[model samples]
Target: MQDKTTLYSLRKTIGILGLALPILLLVTHQDLLSSMSHYYYTAGGVFFILILSAFGLILLNYRGYPKQEGESFSDRLITTVAGICILVTVLIPTKSENPLGTLFFTDYPYLFGHESNGFLGAIHLLSAASFFFLLGYMSFYKFVLNHDASASKNRLFRRSGIIVWASVGALIIIFAIEKILKINMDEVFPAYTFWLEWVAVYAFAVAWLVKGKIHKDFEKMIKTFQTEKSLKKH
Candidate 1:
């Protein structure tokens, strides 16, 4: 019952965020319409819709893994790193110009005009990319790679990897197309590639929220590996 409650909470949280992201962007950045003069409002509108849809999907599918014993320390460390990356990417500025600055720097360019500077900008970009990669890898591992084992009792972990991998693949393909076509991603795709890029982000966030269960699962896998190793030594 406790596990169910936690899972429900996790799903609710993610769903709310997913639903809110688009709304927040729309409400706060409505000026983007005029700022990015070259693009049609349809682009931004569609992107916002996509963001809400992605979150809705997350809310609908929030069943996390159960706890296991004997997890690896490295798993926890990597998860932490990935979480930080995701946070930074979401909170920090992607370009030289800070969004907050616009409040005071009223004269700033209306769109795509801000230039991020120095290490801060670099860190932001690096963190953003790393966040995506870490998210993809972790989700692939949990939902796809480790979904099933001969000895594991939990069935919820099964088939999850496929979902994560599919989402990752979709993101990669979308990114590639955006780059290849030089679609003026900002104007063409609408608000960060239709918010598809954020799925991995939210997935990772869910992973963190359920870290205890995830850690246990990792530990169990590690113990299983060790047991197999010991048996081989006999």
Candidate 2:
């Protein structure tokens, strides 16, 4: 059990650092933002890689855990929708000449100058909007609507939401300052937006960690139910 605890602690630390290092590098090395397109592509790659690594840790930890009797249909559905939204975001860059030329491969000039009439351009914008909406909605639902105040399992959810929202608020404040005060921090910190975006990502990761804890509690509840039934039958 101590070993398991240590492993989880390590995973959480890595997850936090994975979200932080990229931002720190971007902020400290703002010159990199001159190549914004490349920075975004690199950031996206890093995001996906980190997500997969986190998932792998989760799978390892849950190995041999008993499955719930019934499938969580809502969870599965939302996950599928989120996955599709992410796929659309990726495919749009690969297929559309506009996004492809600007974001994916910089071999050619951005003919549209970030405003393309191409089908893929529209798809890309739509995908991004949808991605944000879905995440926001899902986060609200999981951390707010379904939260049980009396349950100790819900503490993580509450704390994760607070952290994620606080980070998001900070990012928004920074953006407002840049726009209103004409303070271009980008000159000093390349890829500022990319790094700022990670706050939201980091929030999601923390939320996932909390969710994992709640899931374990749910699993325990299921086991207790099963045990009670078995004892009654004896």
Candidate 3:
């Protein structure tokens, strides 16, 4: 019962936090965020901090794995590293020109418009990339392990693994296309990467939620999809 409860909580945390990053902007007022003219958006800073805090809590209160015998030392370490990466990503903040928010940066003045310094910008980019990358890796490799015999479980793993990989692949393809076309990613489409980021975040959320058993009657859903795919293939 305790294990079940922990799994449920972890699933909720991962699902909400993952989905919140993208939706935060839509639900927020423009005046409550930054107004960066580049890859960063008006509300990005506060959103980043919110995600950071949520993920921090996740790592702190995570009870997904059993504590007995400390057999999941590596899992714990990976989660810790992932959590740290999330912190770095959030704390560094993106390169913004006009951060309008107060709550996220009241304590960290240096966070706003810090990308002018190349080193800090690099860290922010690296941390953001790594944060999602690790989540994707965890979705594909870690969550799928030791799943039960339920056909729904197997199908859920397959879907989540495919989504994570597909999202990563799509990002790469989009970047390559943008480079080939000489598109100024920030200027051509302000916060274009934001859309891609949301794609990944949504995929991560869905995958983790499924792992958390968010879907009802997913085995039937899987069968329907499989059947449709087979028909299309033929």
Best prediction by TM-score:
3
Q: After superposition, how far is residue 31 of candidate 3 from its true place, in Å?
A: 10
- List the candidates ranked by TM-score, beginning with the highest: 3, 2, 1
Question: Which tens-of-lDDT digit does each residue in 171-190 have in candidate 1?
Answer: 55765886798655545545
Put down candidate 3 lDDT per residue, 1-234, tens digits, no spaces: 137767766876788778776566656634333222222334454665666667866754554554335345445666667778877766666665434343333334443545356687668767766667777766665665654636666566566656666765665676688769976555555555556667777877877777777654467699899999999999
Model 2 misplaced regions, further than 4 Å: 1-31, 34-73, 94-104, 108-119, 143-192, 214-234
lDDT of 3 at 121: 67
TM-score winner between 2 and 3, please give it. Answer: 3
Tens-digit lDDT track of model 2 for 1-234: 225455445435434554564555355334343222233343344543344344334423432112234524243355446556655554454232222123442445433223344676557545544544444444555434442443554555555555555654655677578879887666666545555556556766665555434456569899999999999999
lDDT of 1 at 170: 67
lDDT of 2 at 224: 100
Among residues 3 or more apart in sequence or in different chains, the pairs in candidate 2 whose N, CA or C atoms overlap within 3 Å are 30-189, 30-190
Instruction: Give me the candidate number with maximum lDDT.
Output: 3
TM-score between model 2 and native = 0.46
Q: lDDT of each structure?
A: 0.45, 0.48, 0.62
| Positional deviation of residue 208's Cα in model 1 after best superposition, in angstroms | 9.1
Off by over 4 Å in 3: 29-44, 66-73, 97-112, 149-152, 158-162, 165-183, 186-190, 215-234
Residue 180 alpha-carbon offset, candidate 2, angstroms: 13
